[model samples]
Target: MDRIISLFSSSALLLFILVVQNTSSVYGNAEGDALYALKKQLKDPNNVLQSWDPTLVNPCTWYHVTCNNYNSVTRVELGNAGLSGQLVSQLGQLSNLQYLEMYGNNITGIIPNAIGNLTNLVSLDLYLNRLHGRIPTALGNLQKLRYLRLNNNILTGTIPFSLTTITTLQVLDVSSNRLRGYVPRNGSFAFFTPRSFANNPNLEFPPDAPVAPAPAPLSS
Candidate 1:
């Protein structure tokens, strides 16, 4: 009876260990699936993201993927990888993400509004792509953003007023796009040069095209 009881206890302990292991594996796989879904949304030019296999079980181990000590994804640096395709809204699922770089790709399509969900983002570099559409107003919600580069894309429309709300912004370059309108005269926009605002025909300038000052109050 002693032998049987001991064996049963050992088996139960082993089962518990297996359950914990499976749970960790599941967590990793779920995150991996989210990435895989993103991969499907993008068009991988030159097959660069071919190695982004969800079956790897842990995206943290994948190239360009950085993880926190807790093994959760913290950054994704796929810059100059030649990826293409529209950014899907699911990218917002990376709750802890701080940096995302996908520059120098042929990716086309509008910047997803869901990117505004990455409130913890510190740097976002999507330059030199074929992406079109207006910059999402939701982006102004990224309070932690420091470096934002969206140059050399096909983006159109006026800059969102919410963008001026990113007071934490240190480096912003929306140059070389189709953007047009009155550039905000505060924050980073105050210092931007004609070069930064070049290439767009409809963009109004300061001093040269000063906004007609608000009509002065009528004499009392």
Candidate 2:
């Protein structure tokens, strides 16, 4: 009887330990998965993320990662790093992300429209990268945006009219690309100078483009 009781006690202790470990592991993996998707999208040249080993445990201990009080990602700063890769749509899963600073890299790819799901995003700095593609119209959904810099890219397309809906935008830079078309007449464009749209071989700033003729009235 004594031997059976001892065996049962040991088994119960082991199970308790496993339950706690599994709970912690589950939360850690959730955070890791979010970042794993981001790393997979971008091409990293310097192997900066080599140490982001989820197997080793919490991402809060990794470099260039910042988490909030609830252990959710808040800021992702990879500035000046020799990284390259596409911005994957999986990044949208980081709904609590407030700032994503990825400056000075060879990264190339279209900005994923799924990024619009980051409703809490405040600053998105993708400047000084080799990224090419039309800025996603979904970015206009970021109502809290304060600074947007997509300059010095090979992007070719008209700026989406949806961007005008962002009433909070203050600094908008889309210069040095292949963009063309009359700049939108609202939001920051209402009084922006030629500098904001400079160096585009095909663009015609507002007032430069001739007005379209009004539609003729139809017979009753």
Candidate 3:
């Protein structure tokens, strides 16, 4: 009787472990799927993303991907890897993502509004790219964002006033873009300087600004 009872207890424990592992696997697969979608969109000449195998149960084991103790993706460090191509909206699925550093590449296309879904994001660096189109107001949703750099791109349209509401923002750089309209010098923007808006001739300061500089003449 003791032998039968011990076998039953062990079986139950094994079943419980399998169930827990399967649940975590499913969750990890969702993140992996999101990443694989991006992999399909990119032109990785250097095969930097070659290790992103879909058959893997967890993305944490993949290169350039990082995860927390719970196996949820937290960072994707693929900066300056000679990658060119566009970013897909599926990137927003990384719920635990904090740092998205994909700068100094030839990535072109509009910044996906879906990126605003990463409320936990702390840094978003897309500098030195060929991305164009209006900056999405949805970015205002990132309440925790600290560093927001969109410089050296061919982006057009006015800077979104919604960016002024992020109280936690520390480093704001929109320089060297084709942006237009007045710079927001209030709210969290009070900490920034004109250097942040340099090279954007169309971006001006309001006359009421304490040290209002004359708006530059637009270059033909």
Candidate 4:
């Protein structure tokens, strides 16, 4: 009777484990779709994006794409790949993204406001691209961002004071752009140097105050 009871308990435990495993859900290719959207828009001269297959249920297998243990995309290292074309808004869907390194490309167009949605971002390096337009105020939304470089682009606009709120920020380079107005020298901006704001001939400096101090972060 003891032996029979032990076998029944083992069976029940096994059944429960199976049920849990079967119910476990994947991120469901949402990441894949987002990546494919980028692939469709980018002009990959190096065939770098050739491995990006939309048919796969996940984007982890794609080259230059890094995923965490959870199989969620965490980094996209595509610097100096000779990629062209504008960035897609789908990139904002990568909630777990930590590094977005797309510098030294010929990419053009405005930095999408959707990029502000990447709350988990630690590095946002879009420098040395042919990108134009105003640096989005939405970029200040990255509370976790530490490295923010938008230099060597054709971007035009005042430095968004909202960036001052990023206490985690350690490096900032907005030089060599067509920027105007005054730079924000408050909050985290206190740590930056003249080089960070250099090359923007039209930008006013050593100014009175920022358009506004960094405000409280909004809910993601």
Assess each prediction's global lDDT (C-alpha) against the native: 0.82, 0.81, 0.93, 0.90
TM-score of each: 0.79, 0.78, 0.88, 0.84
Q: Give the per-residue lDDT digits (tens) of candidate 1, residues 29-114.
A: 77677778888988764776677888786788777888898677789888888777777787787777899898888888888898
RMSD in angstroms between candidate 1 and the native structure over all alpha carbons: 8.0
Query: Which predicted model would earn the best lDDT?
Result: 3
Pairs in steric clash, model 2: 42-85, 43-84, 43-85
Superior by lDDT: candidate 1 or candidate 2 = 1
> Candidate 4, residues 1-220: lDDT per residue as tens digits?
9999999999999999987654433463888888889888899989999999988768898999999987789999999999999899999999999999999999998899999999999999999999999988898899999999999999997888999999999999999999998777889997787788889999976755434445699999
Residue 164, candidate 1: Cα error in Å is 0.9
Candidate 3 lDDT, 59-135, residue by residue in tens: 99999999999999999999998989999898899999999999999999999999999999999999999999999
Off by over 4 Å in 2: 1-28, 56-58, 208-220
Which stretches in model 4 have alpha-carbon errors above 4 Å?
1-28, 207-220
**Winner by TM-score:** 3
Which regions of candidate 1 are displaced past 4 Å? 1-27, 206-220
Model 4 shows how many backbone clashes? 0
